[model samples]
Target: MSALSPSAQRVQAVLDGFGLGHRVVEHEGSTRTSEEAAASVGCDVAQIAKSLIFRGKDSGRPILVIASGVNRVDEKAVGRLIGEKIERADPEFVRASTGYAIGGVPPVGHAVPPLVLIDADLMALPMLWAAAGTPNAVFRLTPEELSRLTGGRIEAVRKG
Candidate 1:
């Protein structure tokens, strides 16, 4: 495996601080989308944990949604749950808030602590694959561990 990039290293440091021994796996290229990650990592699409970022329109704060790769987050539902209006955040906003870029944002490391919400659907899976800061690196974690590590509230946020 190649050396972990600075971004990945930051993610590793955060994971370590959490006392979780999850190992980051660096790949040949960026897994920009859940479908791409699923194909590259040989996992079911549903097992890919997409760390989606949104901006709370009312509060002007970042909102992190850790949803199943195959499921689209329902913005309306999320807004209701969090008691704020929300919209999909732009790349610049995401970068400013999360430090990591869109495709490579990790669930644990962020520039600021956003209101994190984990899809309850993700909890049904045994393991989840998520980006490890860099676009080319990733890591695996159990749903329960992910919830605990991020202090995410589990909710049904998928769009029908």
Candidate 2:
């Protein structure tokens, strides 16, 4: 296999550091979107862990929400949970905060530690596929492993 991209390697290193045995795989096609990642990984859309970053309007902090691909985040509800309103982070903010570009933000290994929240729906899945620091790179892990890796509060982040 070819070497993983530098960004992917960073994610792999973080996985290794955490003693998680998950393997990062780079696909020939794009895994940049939820549907694309699901097809690439041969998983249901709901099994894709989509990482979204929001900017806290008050603190200017980054808020990471790892939501299931099939779900839409209720931003207002999340803002309430975090005690502040949040706005969609722009590309520059995303890169500056997470050290990864949009469509490839991982649930872990952020340059600036973000307040994270995991979608409660994802906890029901047996396995999940997540972006691994690049648009074409991904990794799989059990819901339990995800919880361990992120330490993100599991909440009802999905739109009701």
Candidate 3:
């Protein structure tokens, strides 16, 4: 096994800071998409926690939505819950907010803490996989741990 990339190391540090025993696993190929991540990690796509960043149109704050891989986020519902409409965050904004790029955003360790929301559907899964700060890195965790790590409210973030 080789060393973890700097980005992956940062995520590992955050996990350690939280006293979580999860390990960040680095892959040789892309885990950039939910399908790829599931193939690489050998898990159901629905068990992949895909982190999405949105920009609050009014507040100019970052919003983190960790949705199940198979679910599409209902932006309007999220807007209603947060009291502000949200727009898709660009790569620059995503990097600035999360200290990582679009495909590598993790559930924790953001440069600026966003209003974190975990999809309620994800909580039904016994185990989950999430990005670990690099397109090729990931971590395995429980849904309970995910909620604890991000202090994210569980919501019906999925679209109908």
Candidate 4:
């Protein structure tokens, strides 16, 4: 197995915290986009769970939303749910809050616990894949397991 990046290591630690076992695969090229990640992981685009960070309007807290690769986050609905407008967190804010880069941010393992929302659309897939804290690495898990591990709420945060 190849060595994990610092962020990947942190993600692994979080997985360990939940006693979840996962297989990590590292690829040679960029997996920043859904197409790239799907090709690298040999899976359908819908199976990829894209992790997105947003700033909460109410608490000014960081919110992590795990959405399906094929869907887009419904910012307006999300904002309404949080009682404020939702904006994508900038790279600096993302890194500062999650301790991970934009494309490599995982659903778990942040510097602090973030308000997490798991897109219900992702749960339609039997198995979902997500970044393992690095652009070249990914891990697979069930949506229920991911929700349990991250303590995230199941919501329709994404729109088809």
| Model 1 alpha-carbon drift over 4 Å, by segment | none
Q: Worst lDDT window (10 residues) for model 3? A: 14-23
* Candidates by lDDT, descending order: 3, 2, 1, 4
Better candidate number, 3 or 4, judged by TM-score: 3
Clashing residue pairs in candidate 1 are none
lDDT for predicted candidate 1 compared with the true structure: 0.92
lDDT of 4 by residue, 1-160 (tens): 7777777777877787777787666679878877899999889998999889999766778988888898889999888766778777889989899888898888877886788888888888899889888888788899888888888988888764
The C-alpha stretches of model 3 lying farther than 4 A from their native spots are: none
**What is the per-residue lDDT of model 1 for residues 41-126, given as tens digits with 9 covering 90 to 100?**
99999999999999999788999999999999999999999999899899999999999998999998799899999999999999
Provide the clashing-pair count of each candidate structure.
0, 0, 0, 0
Each prediction's Cα RMSD? 0.9, 0.6, 0.5, 1.4
* TM match of model 2 to true structure: 0.99
lDDT (10s digit) by residue, model 2, range 29-100: 999999999999899999999999999999999999999999999999999999999999999999999999
Across residues 116-148, which tens digit of lDDT does each residue of candidate 3 receive? 999999999999999999998999999999999
How does each model score on TM-score?
0.97, 0.99, 0.99, 0.93
Q: Output the lDDT of residue 48, model 4.
A: 92
On TM-score, who's better, 2 or 4? 2
